[model samples]
Target chain A: MDIVVCIKQVPDTSEVSIDPETNTLVREGVPSIINPYDENAIEVGLQLKEEHGGTVTALSMGPPQAEEALRQALAMGCDEAILISDRAFAGSDTLATSYVLAEAIRKVDSYDLIICGKQAFDGDTAQVGPGIAEQLGIPQATYAVDVKVDENRIAVKRLLAGSFETIEMKLPALITADKHMNVPRHAGLRGVMAARKKEIPTWTLEDIEADPEKCGLSGSPTTVVEIFPPQRSHKTERLEGEAQQVARQLVEKLREAQLL
Target chain B: MNIYIDAEKCTGCQLCVKACPYSAIQMAEGLATITEACTLCGGCVSVCPVDAIIWEAPAVEEVDTSDYQGVWVIGEVGEDGLAGVTWELLGKGRELAEDLNTELSLVVLGDEAGELAQKAAQSGPDRVFYAEDPALACYRTGTYTDVISGLINKHKPEIVLFGATEQGRDLAPRIAVRIKTGLTADCTGLEIDPEERLLVQTRPAFGGNIMARIITRNHRPQMATVRPRVMQRLQSQPEHGAEIVEVPVSFNETSIMTRIIDIAHDEAAGQVNLQDAEIIVSGGRGLKKPENFAIIRELADALGAVVGASRPTVDDGWIAPYHQVGQTGSTVQPRLYIACGISGAVQHLAGMSGADCIVAINSDPAAPIFEVAHYGIVGDVFEVVPALTEIVREELGSG
Candidate 1:
């Protein structure tokens, strides 16, 4: 089996804050880390390779700095790493991103399975995995919590709104890892040392035989007309007192508001 | 798609640098230079005081959007019946339909679509397109995408709405890619652009730190997926009769690539119905331990409310993912929401901010959660949560 795990570098949104005066994101000095869920994706791919006796490749599409995320995946045990980055791929949304990723996977030539995190932290669209599957004309199982391979078929336990469903698909299918999939392992000293010397080649549109028109904002159909901070519509009444007193006051307010 | 900064017009005031969320712009040698990090989000285009940054759009064939007509919603069916989000979309779709002066239709696909269609028609759709087949019963991505995309190509509806459920999220993008159209996901606000006559889609991004208003000007059918509780549903009109159009379904089952083996509902059974709950009590990282969730459950049980968890709590394995209340979790609009220990991250706010009444309890006085909360108690969760639960239990028991 040959598994390809897709990952992304994202700003740790927890640490991202807004400037009160300017009402815009204060992105300066924010740390970039691998998207939290993508670690589970890398772990899933590594475990599959361990059990199935196959090679695992880590792939990513982002700016040049995204190579750090691929190196992190390598530190976790991926055999190879590839970064698909180019000026032409800028401003690409999920649809265009999936197209470029599908093209890159096609260039990778042979693969039994493709895995991705359920969604990117920044975008949170959860569209690219299925989009890639659709563009590749293959099957997809999203939000997979567990995956088992049997000869030529794979069974995936997918997480639904509040339930779990088990589904089976053939080889050369796509799977998106849910957070419940597995515990991601940190890079050990030896693993980090090995990954430091690994060569990661960057791929551009021409390298992947991708159409320049279908690469970036030109290929993206959706346009952002306006961007602003979320509106704070509530005027909170703070109850200042001891814990017990505040609790009682809250109950009274709830009763007065008929919410109790 | 080239974006460049004209050096002649540059003032190097660095306004664009502060405006860019991606940090793609930097002042190098007294001029704002674009880097590989630029997503061309156009953040710099409007913020440039000197209008030095230029975005060159690629020329493409203009789409004949004039030919498209009517507003359509793809209805979904759950284990019990039509999902609440289906009704919510219909309720909103009716308004969009009225805005466009077009008919609103609900497309129902299932093995027993005929019965579901009858049940759905009373919900205020002008018409219901019932596409029934065994192959259509379970939502296989390929089968549903093929059928819906085919119908879209044939009908050419002006606008299409989908519930941003797991199934809808899984299916919408594939259909969009197949038909080469645009789709906006998890839109909280949808309206008709008065001047351009386009669907203006507004959604939260960067974990609710920012909101973007999106538009698909050139696409024939404007598509968007809305979260379940984001939109309200119109009441069913018993007197309103709808025309039912039977769609012929012809797809090879053997050609389908994936098969459903089994489905196991939540072991807690029916407890995960946060979407329709009237009240919810959610806990966050303040609990400090997984076992500490008992107080949250106690409070929820006392109030007959459902249990919800913040993303951090769920991510830390303190609770199941289904109990998560945030952008990545379920968006809920309950009558009253009690958030304990949750400092109100923007992502968590995106989910439960719509509650009729929000009461936040955290030790921190300046936690961001209080900004949108209707009531705030600056106290420890361990102390405040148990007290609240005790009072609620006594009050409800006596009442």
Candidate 2:
């Protein structure tokens, strides 16, 4: 019943803003937090640990600064934390990132299940989780809103368009956590101090035996050629009146637009 | 490829120099100049009003792109029949195919897909592929990917498109990984390069703050999953039948990694009609809490519209996820979109901004939602919603 939760630190997407004058991201004062969805992933792992009496480990692949994110995971009831960071992996895309993570998981070598957030807030790409499952030749269920675990298999309630489909898979399968899987627990003082006592392990690409060519920008099949703010040219006709009067005007406008 | 300036068209605007985040653009003698440090992010191209910047990349190692043929869309099952996004993709996909001088094809995979395949072809695909097995009835990541990847290997379609729905999002990436291809997700715009015959995918990046135009260089059978409702559907339903091909797949249900036990629906069924609704009323985190959503519901009822929620409200369990209208939720292009207490996060804006008339009601006049709104009311939702609802009710009663 051992579990590994793959997590990432991302710019708090809500606060991240673009400078109007520069037309570039004003990343200076933005805070980095464990991706909003990954907190649910961490919560799901801890819940499984509490129910099944197994150890939960948090894994992340990012810069050295991401180690803080792992410490936060430890404070949230994980037994151990591992940070996989290397200069070679700086520009890694989903495929390359999954490769390093899969290799690291093989190195950990004791897990029955792996969990990842549905998607990172910044990239908003739900590729790496399935990519890891594909790389490791295991089954994966993405966008799981609820999960129940036992010694042999895991049952998941996956979020679809309008309904929740209950799915079951054997051990060693991967599940991507969706929002509201569980309310992530806030770390208390005792847990925060205990987290400091735990030694965090750092792994380099070479430590995982990752192929150099397939580990970073060189291996990524896609590249970003152009990125610019969405050009929005909208002019609104403001309605200024008491609420009731404004509401009447809205109906009149809709009538004028032939929408009614 | 080298970046250059068209001096004739240059208006001596230095905006590009300031727009370059990398300091790659310098103002040289009152004209913008590109430095060697330029990453070619196309920042200057967007800022240039006179179209003065020329960022050119010559056709590199032209290996007859014509070898790639046929535009393909994966189909999904909906309540009555095929999903709306499936039809939307087919409609948009047909344009891409024609631009490339190729045929538009479709593949429907499910437990029982023979009928679904025919339904897919009714959308005007040149050929329809039914890769059916009982195992596909509910999506198991492994089996679905293998079957579609196998079809891809055999048929070798040049371009493949999918809906950014729950099923398509889950299946498309797995297929892309298995077949060793690149996939762009949540695309809002798609076009084919007439000369190089590459799929040009335009999608929001960095949480909709920026629009990224991505191309997978040297990848065969370019793949993209377009968001629902962003594309225009065909005016007429398919009057003629299309060619159908049944793709053979060998699989045992037990061999797949996952099995679906049951599907449970959330309670917001009747109110969650954001996709097809001609008029929609949506609320956001500004509703304060789940109970306050009653204001949104009341407004929707008075207008005879379906109720939609933003991502935050749904994530907070105030409403069902299906009722959400945003980047991660259903992209609705309703004729009239009334947003209450919505500050309009970029993701939310990307979803519903395409509506014919967007009315935003937020107490904060500075909210970004006002930028795209056709009508902005700076008033409290508590006050505005009730007043609006009563007036609408009275207006309708008078009518």
Candidate 3:
């Protein structure tokens, strides 16, 4: 029951800024961190590894600095780590990204379960997980809040719009995790010390035997043409009066807004 | 263009056919098939429950590219002045126009929306097209689309941009369907390829994990909708010079179905203005109990901000759905976001991670929320939140 957890290093969006002049996000000084959602996937993978007595590998695709995310995963108890980095991978959209990731997963073919966070924080597009599933021609259960591994199958509780659906899928399936899945464990001093000595394998498109056309920006179907900050024009109507009066004013305002 | 359908993956959802609205998709042998009538709007590409449909326009072999003209932004003005999103679109329009070495224009609708037209002029657009009429006062999807589609037909703008607001969201899709064009929604980024003269529309897809880029390769007007507060608004300068061409429009009452019964002014919802709130204090399932939500309310009140919740908290009836933030909930961009006892799940993060600053307070140091938070405090939020609230209150009082 080898498990593969896919993680990404994203610009801490909170620290991300739009250069007013360029009208694009300023990624220069912003620190990078493991995508919040991926952390849960890593935790789940490590826990499953502990219980199942199998190897857990943390895999990521990004620039060189992405190694930090892999290291973090190793510190959190993943048995191994792999970083798929290359210049051509830059500017890849979800479509191309999934293609490359799927190729990388194929390179690590022995894994029985592949876990991913439901989505990444910076882009907030949940497309890649399913996109990878599509490219790999595998079944996927997204938004999994709970997962249990069986002898040859996996049962998962999927979060839907207003309800939960339990699904059973075969091994070697893809599962994108929701935050409710589990609380990720912290890397303690002992784990941190052990992580420093762990070896992280790096792979490029060629190393993974990926087709150059299908692994980078060229493989991407979409492109970005422009970006600008959203405009906000809100006229604040401050309410000031006695409690009952303020409540009355509030109700009147709600009525006007057609919400009441 | 070549259409690819993975029949093995197709669930025969018919969402693509229903969304077509153009009668382009038909059921053939228990599978959805694209007919010759298809205009390649790509609406079905995203709506598919399973990743079954794949449509690709043939690579531009013979590129005329000459007939496609300027970039036009559909300017919107509510009962007030120009909508904030319209100005943002103008700013983006300017960029796309420059990339293509073409001119930028604004199409304004509504009676006396000329003030906004003049404002659009200051954003450095080359021209302004005005269509003023009483019927255009309230947003009617059919009427507004009719007016804009008419103008688009008359002047073939190569690229068109719209704000992904409630109105823009409703209007753009309908107009795209009617005009047989492609429309992408909630784009976070955009770029233009100088060589191809194509507008690259990038947006978060699949909830918010990956950025998906969509392009209207063969469509006349490459249309995209940008979310509000995701773009910068240009400053209005009265002195900026521009020319406005007024177009006549006759609206028949039969075309409009929905009517504004009444425009009541509500204070409670309007006062919070969560969309624009600089500070947001949100609670989630970890709040322990529903009654403890008062702590979140207290903190939000102290900071003169809005209170938000996660889907689980809202599902538990601790708060309303409107207050929930996630993939299915509202996408917010605040200056500061404080999560009290929240576990920082991906769904909740999808909604609020766009904030400038995030502070996560949870008893578990291993909570996923801390991974994205700029400031993290590992402790019981029940104890930490009250103290933080008191400090904020004191600071506000002192100021």
Q: How do the predictions measure up, each by TM-score?
A: 0.95, 0.86, 0.54
Of the native A-B interface contacts, what share survives in model 1?
0.78
Candidate 3 CAPRI assessment class = incorrect
lDDT of 2 by residue, A198-258 (tens): 9998899889988877766655556566776777676788998888778778788988888
Tell me which of candidates 1 and 2 scores higher on DockQ: 1
**Residue B392 shift from truth in candidate 1, angstroms:** 1.9
Q: Can you list each candidate's DockQ?
A: 0.68, 0.39, 0.03
The lDDT of each candidate is: 0.88, 0.80, 0.70
The model with the greater lDDT, 1 or 3, is: 1
Model with the higher lDDT, candidate 1 or 2? 1
Q: On residues B1-399, what C-alpha lDDT tens digit does candidate 2 reach at each position?
A: 246899788878776775654456677787777765454446567778888998754333333545667988888777777788888888898888878777888888887799887766665888899977877776667777887888888888888888887777787877877776678888988887777667788987666777888887766678888888788774445485789999888787567677778888855643475767889999998889899999888888888888888887887789876788876666677889999988888678767877888999998988988888998999888888888888788878631
Tens-digit lDDT track of model 1 for B1-399: 478999999999988887777788899999999987988888678777778989876665689998999999998898777888899999999999999889999999989999999888876999999899998888888888988999999999989999888999999999989988889998989999777889999987887778889888787688999977778787888999899899998877678898899988876625867877889999999999999999999999999999999988887889987788876677788999999999988678867887899999998988988888899988889999998888888888931
lDDT, candidate 1, at A25: 80
Ten-residue region with minimum lDDT total, candidate 2 chain B:
B57-66
Candidate with maximal lDDT: 1
Which of the two candidates, 2 or 3, achieves a greater DockQ against the reference? Answer: 2
lDDT for each residue of candidate 1 in A62-165, tens digit (9 for 90 to 100): 99999999998899889999999998899887779999999999999589999999988888889999999999999999999999999999999997755788
List of clashing residue pairs for candidate 2: A112-A172, B111-B137
